[model samples]
Target: MPRPTPSPRPRRLGVAAALAVALTLVGGCGTTSSSGNLKVYQQEQFEPGETFSRMFDASVSQTCEAARRALLSQGYIVTVLRPDAINGSKNFQPGGEAHVQITFNIVCTDDGNQGKLSSAYVSATQDRYTLKKSPNSASVGVSAIGSLSIPFASTDDSLVKVASETIPAGVFYDRFFALMASHLKELQMDAAVD
Candidate 1:
């Protein structure tokens, strides 16, 4: 009788199998924490004409409030304001040109299996401007993703930082707002406001 031949297993196949098994086990191991306790502190609305101090305070307040509401939906315990006062500024031109600047001082602490993790963050001066008003205010859609070092902090802080740092103050007014205006009629017909 002729000798029976055995099937050969490729080296790559063995390595790939091991990698997949390792990834599966690692992915299933750790539990992430819930971000249900963050608090937000809003300053107040800063209009175009006001003392520099008051205007700045209002800007910080508005930004903090907006950030807080957005973050809450994602399950974060955020404190929008610091113990010390923050400063902000907003400028508006006659032809619907507007500029805004906001700064923040933040301190946060959270507990996880690795131990308590705390960080102090200072996000300084996010400025934006708008040139034209939108006909359909609802058309403006702002979204952010933020994340902390904690196991379950799902928010991507990098997005927030990018929005703050890179977006020009008045680009929305010139572009996004204009788009909203052109689409207002259609938007109203299709959507109902509460």
Candidate 2:
């Protein structure tokens, strides 16, 4: 027995479907406005500490988080947050007591269609030292002395600069909306075609 042939309408529908798929693929490839698809989220900051060591951690955490949030608002996805220690030292006072100094590390990551884009480790530290005087000393003993140290403190500055320079909201939106308008133009062109 001879098999029934497929209807012409079915064959036309199949061709139309294939053509739609091809057009979509071509459109996606030709369009450079992937910027509109980008998304930015919030930034995170670390905690503060009482002591030098803890303060160092706090500084980095706070700064890095701020940077992360800024980037997120610009559509970058944060992936990591970690601290790096720079140097440790001791400060000696006239009385015979010593203080310790420490620094912190900053790391952040972002996700994109291409891959993960990450910022470099930004470092920040805050150190405090207190000196104690000997009671036996005849001279009026100093009650206490204090000092603080911070390294890589400029991370915040750099982050701010980058954010301002890279993600100007006015400029970004203008370009984004313009690209969208162009896509609409393409759609209109397609619609006008027979």
**Could you tally the backbone clashes for each prediction?**
18, 10
Model 2, 1-194: lDDT tens digits are 99998789989999999999999987875643455442232222233421112111123333344444444444433444444212222222333333433332334333232332223233333354554332221234345744433343222211111111112224433443343334444544655693
Error of 2 at 114 (Å): 3.8
Alpha-carbon lDDT of model 1: 0.36
Once fitted onto the true fold, the runs of candidate 2 whose alpha carbons sit more than 4 angstroms away are 1-100, 111-113, 134-194
Candidates in order have lDDT scores of 0.36, 0.38
TM-scores of the models, in the order given? 0.19, 0.20
